[model samples]
Each structure stands twice: as C-alpha cells, then as structure tokens.
Target: MSGKTRIALVTGGSGGIGRVVATRLAADGMTVVVHYAGNPAPAEEVAKEIAGAGGSAVTLQADVTEPERVRELFDAVEQQFGGVDVVVNTAGVMILKPVTELDVDDLDRMLRLNVRGAFLVSQEAARRLRAGGALINFATTVRKLALPTYAGYAASKAAVEALTPILAKELRGRDVTVNAVAPGPTATPFFFKGKPQEVIDQMSKAAPLERLGEPADAAEAVAFLAGPARWVNGQTVFVNGGVI
Candidate 1:
C-alpha cells in the first residue's frame, strides 16, 4: 500500500458517539474523514479538533442512503488520502414506538437510513477498502433486550446484525473484516434527550456495571476493531456494560 498513512471514513461523524469514534481513530494514528449528512459545521469542528490535537482529519458530506453520494464520498477519500483503510458506519436514526403504535412512515425513514444506509456503506467498503481494512457498522443492544417502544429502532439494527457476518463471508479473501458495534444506553445528549430523570436513573442502574455506557467506551471498542482486532470478524460486539 505504498506506506501511505491509513485513512478512516466515519459516517455521521458529527453526532454524539460518532464524533468520539472519529477522534479516537484519529488519535490512533489514522487520517480521519468526518462524514456528515446534513450539517457541515459540526463535522468541520470535529476535523479541526482532531487537527488541533496534532492528528490529521478532514470533513466530508454524504447521505449514506444515496448511492451516488456514497460513491462520490469514497472517490473523494481515495483521491485525497490514497485509499480508505477503515469505515465506521455510524450514521443512523432511532424512532422509538411500540410495534402497534409505530407509524409506518417513521419506520420507513428509520429503515432507509439505518438499514439501507448501512448496506450502501458496506457495499462500497467491500468494493474499495484496502486489504487490511475493516468496516464497522452500528447496531444497538436494544435488539437483544427487546425493550418496549424500541420496536422500530431495534428491528432496523437487527437487520444490521444479520448482514454483518454475511458481508464478512462475502469478503472472504479480501481480508476486510465486517463487524457491527452494538452500544447500550450511553451517556450522550441523544440518550438523555426527552427522558425523565427517573427513567434515566433506572436505565443507568439496569446494567450490572450500575452505570450507563460512555461515548468513549463505545469508541474504545471501535478503535480495537478498526486497528488490532483483526481476528474479530462477522460479529456484533456489545459495548453496553453488560446491559443484556
């Protein structure tokens, strides 16, 4: 690979956990590409933060659900950084509603981003990633817990889990490990939004660890998979503090 610096493209890099993952990878010595969907400000801030910390990073925008945009994203990365060595598909949305109450439109929107977006990213990664690269997708621990009102979100992430190992097998000789990181309740603004204090407290204590997962905790797992956990393939690593 010409001894070029490894590059990592993190989708939704502007969001809570996504921001942390991007910085963590950059700190791990990879040139980071912070990909955002709608807003560039946050993404640019993340890139600048990484650069300020003496790491290399840049911002890119792409709607993961769109094929052409995703392709262009890869093209830009390849042209600028040589080639992508890691892709963390953290771009996803969660719409909480019980099965009976879930609006079909909301379900469709979530599926479009969470499932289809993941597929598009995985497809491109399979086609373009360097031999030693790894593709990490996002899943959720709710898929295993089967919590109420999370039916739609859980279903979407469940699909992600299903495709993970299959993608890994399909990439057999390519040497690109395909895996998903499933995070439990994490201490992110997204997690705390609109939830009551009592509810948050109960969730915080639900895990045997007696606390909510941190963004850095999830970031650590991603760093492991992105760099040294080459032997871990086609599996969903739960970073939820034993929450299931």
Candidate 2:
C-alpha cells in the first residue's frame, strides 16, 4: 500500500449494511465518508466509533434520488478527503407487497429509492471516482428466489443488477470496478421489522444454509470489491450463503 491512504464514500452508512461497510473500510485504512439521507445522529455515532478505533471517518448527508444533493455530497467528500476511491451505495428503502396489492405510492417510493436513487448515485460516482475506484450497488436475493410480497422491491433491485455490469464497461480503461452485492435475508431491523417468528423461521429455512446473513458478512464482500478485487468488475456477487 502507498503512503497516500485511499478514500471511501459509503452512502446510507447511518445504519445496517452501510454502517458496517463504512467501519470495515475504515479498518482497511481508507478515510471513509459516511453518508446519510435524513437523520445524521446514527452517522455521527458511526464516525465517532471509527475515530475511536483509530480509523478516519466523517459523516455527510444527501438525498440519493436527487442530483443536486448528490453532487453536493461528492463536493463535501472531495473537500474533506481529496478524492473518493471507493463508493459503496447502500442507500435504499425496501417496501414489500404483492404487485396486485401495492398502491401507486408504495410502488413509487420503492422504485424511486431502489432504482432511481441507485442510478443517481452511480451517475455521480462514475463522474467523480478517481482511478482504482469501485462502485458497489446493493441488491437482494429475493430477485433470485421469486418469493411472494417482494414484487416492486425485486423489480427495482433487478434493474440494479442489470445496469451494474454495463457501468463497469462504460468506465473502460479507467480501472474503476462496478459491481452489485446481493445479500440473502440479513438479520437487521430492516429485515425483521414486522415479521412474526414463524414467518422469520420459514425464511430462515428457505436458504440452504438455514440462517439469515449478517450485515458484516455482506460488508466483507463489499470491502473485497472496493480494494484489491480489481478483476471483479461488472458482476453481481451474491453474498447469500448459497441461497438460490
């Protein structure tokens, strides 16, 4: 590694998978910019934790779906860290419902965040990431499983999986990788929000591993794609314990 440390911008780092990704990258010695959309408390705590552990971190906020706010976010990162070498976009919302049962607003919200928001983030990252950079988008194993009540969410993430490789090719000789990490049912507040034990148990048994994935497990994959995995561009690396 060179004396010049790498910089990372982890969107949605306020909590869950994003927070873990930020912390792990910091441990890898990259100065991380933890991004949040609304509240900054969780992000601030994350930054403090990173600093306390001898890693460098700073918290920033932006609306992932909006272009101007996203631009402002990259500006903040540039001013603070010189340039970004890794961009792990974990900012998204998952609203599950059967396609027939979903209201227009529900579908709209999911598409805006999961699809449009990811596009906007990729656009900015493509424009700004320095050489040897990476852009890892988030997808879910549900797209592969085709389970009930995930119609809208699955469709949006499927789009993410589809576009990721093309983005990698677009970057051509830039040496920036573009990939998507698709995690199985992870044990997090977002995953357990309203499910009963039986439903959770059923899901737990659905995967061959018979357990929900940990957020840290997915983070490890992202860390790999961000650093030293230059040949891993343009693919959806499934972090789901063989959950086909």
Candidate 3:
C-alpha cells in the first residue's frame, strides 16, 4: 500500500454490488475505474462520491460483450491509471424463466453478457494485470441452488465458474490470481423490485443469517480477494449467508 496507488477496474459500477465494490476499493487506496454499460449518470455519481471522499476515480463506458469495446475500456484505464492492479467483472443480466418457457432472445442476451462479456474483460485484464494483481468475476448462488425459473441465468454463471479456473491457470506465471464470488438473495434494489413483500420476507428468512445479503457484504469479499489474499485462487467464494 506504500508504493504507487493501486488501480482497480470494476465493470457495472453503476449498480448494486459493483458500485459498492468500486467505492470500497477507492476507500482502500486504489484509484478506481468505474465502468458502466448504458448508465453513465449513476456511474459518475459513484465516482463523484469517491472523489469527494479524497479518493481517485474515473468513469468509463463499454459493452463488455463486444471485444472492441472491452479493449477500449482497458486502454482507457491504462491511459488514465497507468496500469491495472485489480479487475472485477460485475456487469451481468438475469432473466428468470423455466427452460421450456425461456425466450431465445433472453437466453442469448444472458449468454452474451454474462459469459462472453466476462471472458473478454478477463482476457484483457489478464494481459495487463501486474504480477500480484487479482481478477474477480461475479457468479451467482443460482448455480448451486438450481432454482426452477433460473435455468438460463444459472447456466451462464456456471460458465463463469468454469472459466475461473482456466483463467487462473493461464495467468499463473504472472502471479495474477483469478476467482469468482457467488452471492445469494442480496437486498439490492434489483432483488426487491416488483416482488411481493411476503415473498421477499420469506426469501430473506430462508438464509441461515435470517437476512438478505447486503451490497456491502459482497463488496467485503471482493475487497479481500482484490488484496492480501494471494493464496485464494481459482475459487468461488459464496457470499450467500449459508442459503445453500
């Protein structure tokens, strides 16, 4: 922490877990690259908060599923921050549907964003991340729970988990660690939106902790993996409060 300020790139910095993770990394002394796909306002707000707190941050927009956009994102980070020390892929879309009823467009959208997007961003990060830097991808507890309506979404996250070990091995010589975090039933706006209050309460109580996970809860795990946890590689740390 005494050398050059670390640089962290967090995809989907406009939303729940990503926003919290970016802010926490800034607080931890990393110069943050807050990346958003379509929403710049919220991303800028997160960066502004970091700046107000005396931390350094910038916002970049990229559709990570597109290889060219992903490349541009890394280039912008390099231009601004000099080099990247940590990369977090938290940009994702979830469309819940039973396999038989799943829309083809929705399936493709999830695959493109959750799987292809993650791979592209991770590849770029792997190329640029310094030795001792970390690459973190966001997965989901649905991969384990196999909930009825989440087949496609879970399949995509399962791909992410599959890619984690391969990327870790690919980056082994560089001393760059790769891992995934799977969070369950978080109390993010996305989770509570349009859902019945009773259903939300039931889901919250299902976890052993008897509460929905918070954005800060997952961010804590991301922060740990980003720093001072070199031994934890190619692993998926579940931040589900023992729901699974």
Candidate 4:
C-alpha cells in the first residue's frame, strides 16, 4: 500500500468493548475514527485518551442503522484520511428475555442495531475499504451456548455470524478480510446491568478460564483480525475463553 497511515473506523467506540478496540487499534498505529450513536462525550474521551498516548484518533457520530448516516460516517473519515483500511463494527445492543416473555419492542431494538446496523456498516466497508483492509464485526458466544433469556440477543448476533463469512467472500480479490469476534460474558458495565450478584457469579465462572472476559480480551482478538491474521477470514473467532 501507499505510505499513508491506515485508517480504522470503530462503531460504538464510546463505551464497552468498542472503546478498548478503538484504543487498541490506535496503539497499533492505525488512525482511529471513534463512532458513537447518540452521546459524543464518551467518544470524545476515548479520542482524548488515544491522543494522549500519542496515537491518532477522532470522534464521529452517526446512527449506524441509517444508511445515510453510516455513509456519512465513512465519508467524513475518508475525506479526512484519504481512505479507510480497517472497519470494526462494534455498534450493537443486547436485550435479554425468554422467547415466551420476549417483548417485541425489545427484540426489534436489538435486531435493528445488531443486525441492521451491522449490515449498513458492512455494506459501506465492503464497498469502500482499501485493499488489505479488514472488517471485524461483533457477535456473542451466547449464540452457541444457547443460554436462557438470551434468545432475542442471540438471534440478532446469529445474523451477524451468518453474514461475516459471506461478506468475506464477496470481497474476494480486494485483500480485505471479514470476521466476527464473539465475546462471552464480558465484564462491561452493560453486561452487569440488571443482573443479580448470583447470576453474575455463575457466568463469571462458566468459562474454563474461570472469569468473565475483560474488554481488552476481546480487543486482542480484534487486533489480530485487524492486523496480522491474514489467512483468518470469514470466521467468527470466539473470545469467550472456551465457554462453549
């Protein structure tokens, strides 16, 4: 490629695992675009942290589910950086409920962000990313574990898993790899929300590693797909410490 620095757009980079992934990519020397849906404060903070560490990063806002907004997000990045080389789609939501108790509104919310948002972003990445680029999407290990109260979330992530490999093949000859990172029971604030202590304890120890995943754990996997894992394409790399 040219001597220009690589550019990476990380959706939902304002918080949770997305924040760490943005930070990690910046540290690895890619110019990071931190994309947030609503709030810009957290996204700004992430950019500041990366800047302080001598890494290049800028914050951008977009409703990822909206095609126009997603295109704008990439447009801004490309206009400023010349072109994007890595696109990490970490923008998504999770709503836990048994199928019988499922609230249709909650399911729609999850699907809209998790599946539709993922598709819009992936579509842009597939069309625009530079050669040798990579697009890493987020999934959840619960899809395979088949846990209770996760039907809505799992179904949405299942769509993410399903689309990953297909997108990789579609990008054939472009040298850009498409993959998903399925994190299991990560200890983000969102993960602990609405869960009791007992339930948290149980999940923390479910993995053979005997603890919940940290955002950094998942970030490491994304880093691999974003950078050195050249042959690893169209696959969901489970970052759950073997929970399944």
Predicted candidate 3 versus true structure: per-residue lDDT over 39-143, tens digit per residue: 689999999999999999999999899999999999988887678999999999888778999999999999999999999999999899987799999999978
**Clash-forming residue pairs, model 2:** none
- Comparing 2 and 3 on lDDT, the stronger one: 3
Candidate 1 clashes between residue pairs 3 or more apart in a chain or in different chains? none
Count: clashes, candidate 4? 0
Residue-level lDDT of model 4, residues 151-225, one tens digit each, is 999999999999999999988899899999999999998899899999999999999989999999999999999
Question: For each candidate, C-alpha RMSD in Å?
Answer: 1.1, 1.1, 1.2, 0.9
What TM-score would you give candidate 4 relative to the actual structure? Answer: 0.98
Model 2 residue 137 CA deviation (Å) reads 0.6
TM-score of each: 0.97, 0.97, 0.97, 0.98
Give candidate 3 misplaced runs (Cα > 4 Å). Answer: none
State the lDDT at 136 in candidate 4. 97
Worst 10 residues of 2 by lDDT: 1-10
The CA lDDT of each predicted structure is 0.93, 0.91, 0.92, 0.93
Regions of candidate 2 where Cα sits further than 4 Å from its true position: none
Instruction: Give candidate 4 misplaced runs (Cα > 4 Å).
Output: 1-3
Q: Choose 1 or 3, whichever is better by lDDT.
A: 1
